[model samples]
Target: MKINFKNYIASIFITVLMVSIFSSCTETKEEVTLLFVGSFTDKKTGEGIHVYEFDTETGKSTLKHTIDSITNTSFQRLSPNGEYLYSVVDSQKKYNGKVAAFKVDVPNKKIDLLNIQDCGGLNPAHLAIDSSGNYLVNSNYSDGSLSLFKINNDGSLSENSQVLQFKDSSIIKSRQRASHMHSANFSPDNNYVFAHDLGADKIRGFELVKKQGKVSLENPKEIKTKPGSGPRHFAFHPNGRFGYLVNELSGKIDAYTYSNGNLGFIEDYLTYQQKQHIYRTADIHISPDGKFLYASNRGPEEDTIVIFSVDENSGKLQLVGHQSTYGEHPRNFGIDPSGNFLLVANMYTNTIVVFKRDIVSGKLTKLPFDISVKNPSSIQMKTY
Candidate 1:
């Protein structure tokens, strides 16, 4: 019959304004960071590396991709430029354990396999890339050796540049029967490499020498830990003067003053106050901002993350608090690039739990959401 022309005009104007506002908001939204989770694959359990899109603002994660061909990608490291990712395949078969390189395609959220090289030892567990991105180092647990690889210009790995095996064993009869190198990392200056040997109870240092574009290890030095300590992982503070060595057997953290790649002992801090239960310490990490340190431990009945506040001036750690992982056997954990969230990969429970971090207090509060993956051993993040 009759139409109200004024009302119709007002409705059209409101729709146009709302669309413009929505478009502007969408255009200004921040991009999501990509998180890559490595896991142990098997015949009975689902396996592969999982890619997740993480929202920094809301601390939410969504699975984006999965790569299943490689088994036992238990540990991974990203190149400094974020253009390539390297992972160690932990296996017991002789010379079967390998290190693999993958070219990262960030825009499409895919990784192209570049090359896989034998790690020159058995059961390669951890790997690290040098600051120049020219060399890769790996620690072999079963054979107690360290292997070095040169990086080609295109990010593929060259043949093993060097491999050094250890013969010494500590006093522990069962766990330290032979030297087992658990973790390897480059010094802040990239002039030295530190390999933490669990069975030897020592953090061994080797000079990284480059001559005429070829790299070699020399001038071996050893930093002894407590008897049967079983140092598993190492982390350097952002200040480059302090180093943290987490002992897997004793459940203790050793603070060291690092100068010119030499580590001088500072003090020992216990991860757990109560000593009644057996402690199985797993991983250690420092926050990006260098304000806090976190260590994961899997006890007989409980899995927890211990937090500590870093004293910037003195390079000392003060116990802050602890948070239960709500899962079993937290093998590894990672801090987001922003240091706002922490993700723990509980191996036995097969879950990755997210926790919101309180930067000011150096505390972790569990988030409601948890990611389910089979035998998740490591969690690493890369920002887009």
Candidate 2:
């Protein structure tokens, strides 16, 4: 058939218009939504967990849902695909040691209870999922044990995949006398798991030996800190070039040179606390861009957030300065996934304070607004 030139041009334009419209529809995927999981059941009322919705762009939030799946759910993290969320229910039910997984239907704002797995450690304080979402690591503060669970494709966790026990004694005999696994983190390659044992005063490393989807421990070793240096939380650089582990007891952040999932001592430790001070530090987080680091000092002498500049060349942290949290006992704080805002969980004050980030300067300015929570221990952000 003979085609007219004018019609040919019109047809091409029409096709281009349709393609642009389809692309416009694809823009919906750009907006990232966040989930804030904080259990409101404190020493008083048992109101279950409060999951809130957060907007990265507008810095706005709304109450999403309250889940009563477990008692005292504290820490939460999403799978790589953002499909499921795993939480640690820090229970005082006498060795209850429970962890729960929830299947999230993001767009619909829905969650289905998946299953609960025994943490294998007492009072699982913090939980972290490997990059591949294959293993979930828990830090049992009371039990002083590290438990790792493999996540099946069905969102159900595998049966007690592995557990590593720690041994030691420190200043707090009754509290930190034995083993207190404060935090568990995985290397980017997911080949090694590093756990901070507060009571042990050491950072323990283990090889996540994988066989047929079951994980076994290999090459277990401990990096000793100063006596009574209660190692707490740590963060990995974005480029996977370096790792920073923070010691809450000693108030120091140790930088390391990590390679192929193995960490080499940079042989340098950066102190974030003042002399002769004890504040029971909480959480540490690296910026999304991995250019900076932030560590929180929990209580006692002036609650503040210590900021540091990350040297990309050496993976060492240079102290930036401390910012007044404007609240009490900042146990947990989170840098938004977008690297724009920071929200601190002031435990005793029952407030979540906000800060505006200076992307250029890498400093935080206090914002007037804050949210109230019963006892927010740790904070995490997940977007879909």
Candidate 3:
């Protein structure tokens, strides 16, 4: 055959291009996971919400975007579908807080405001969306109430459908003179909503009643704790049979057996090994596999993540050990979905630290990565 140099070069180029295209099509696409952090900022300005592109394998994070228009986003929650985010805007003033929803665009690194609705109370601290995505409940700390909202089809919040004010007080006159509802969480089965009343020292449960296609919280059930315990946050095990309540004032974790809209007390474990006169327990979360439980303690005396291994059979916790958050005021922390990494938001230090979690041993080793976020109060993760 006659040799043609130009034709030979063109043939080689076409073959290389064909192989590249085939390989690109056959390779798996990496899933993008995002970490959303909400912060407490000055009146109506500064970084309210931060979006970070998190590396699941390396336990590293890169800031992707920040939403500043929404101010004082002290706490936030992602919807069940991970398409929307709802946050509470706790302002400097103790009155007139707001809850806003946003449409999350991961690829574009954008968060568009869907709508803002009056929280029906002041200083909304925490909020929760039901698994069905049709209802939202917000806890107002200053106003001492829980506001329930009906979520529209587009993820916007309807004006609060109901607001329940709690006037009960506890023995601690300074911190519990009046009701202070701090956090709200829905049952894993979505049959009940629990409101943690820090001032009242109670975990109040409400049955999710559906009447004529509308849902409302009714038939309240109350679980009383030690008078000065100050129930702040509640976490349910993945199995939904066990629950943990972290008391802010007493630095105690109360384990409970959850059944039929009631929490039966199991046993109480101290979050701190040594009793501190001034310390607060901030957040509590269980590993995805329900093997370990972690609680953050903030203080003038202590800043650590108390680890506990769960006894799956008895629903009890055994202290696994403590890990220094390596920062100040470990306010809130989140474990990635794969249960491989735990990220802690150290509010006072303005840093978010990532820790590599050992799946088999359930211990955490601090990673060298630190993400700076001002006054971070909440940490939530979502993978898309």
The root-mean-square deviation over C-alpha atoms between each candidate and the true structure, in angstroms, is 6.1, 3.2, 3.8
Global fold similarity of model 1 (TM-score): 0.91
**What lDDT tens digits, residue by residue, belong to model 1 across residues 1-384?**
798999999999999999999998879645558888988886222356788888887778898788867678888899988888888874544554889899988878878889999899988889889888989999899989999999999999998989999998998788899999999889998899999999999999999998998889999999899998999999999889999999988999999988997898989898875683567888999999999999998877658999999998888899998899989999999999999999999889888999999999989998887899988988889787
Query: Which pairs, if any, clash in model 2?
Result: 144-179
Runs of candidate 3 exceeding 4 Å displacement = 1-28
Q: Per-residue lDDT tens digits of candidate 2, residues 41-156?
A: 65333545566678666676676676754577777777888888787775554665778888886676657788988888777778888888777888888767877787888888
Per-residue CA lDDT of candidate 3, range 1-384, in tens?
898999999999999999999999999977999999999996667789999999998988988888976779989999999999999885545678999999999887657899999999988888888889989999999979999999999989999999999899999898999999999889988999999999999999899999998878999978899879999999999888999999999899999998888888999999996989876899999999999999999877889999999998899999999989998999899999899999999999999999999988889999999998889889999888
The CA lDDT of each predicted structure is 0.88, 0.77, 0.91
* Residue range with the least summed lDDT across 10 consecutive positions in model 1: 40-49
Clashes of each: 0, 1, 0
Regions of candidate 2 where Cα sits further than 4 Å from its true position = 1-27, 43-45, 171-175, 267-273
User: Which candidate comes out best when scored by lDDT?
Assistant: 3
By lDDT, rank the candidates, best first. Answer: 3, 1, 2
Error of 3 at 42 (Å): 2.8
Return the number of clashes found in candidate 2: 1
- Better by TM-score, candidate 3 or 2: 3
Candidate number with greatest TM-score:
3
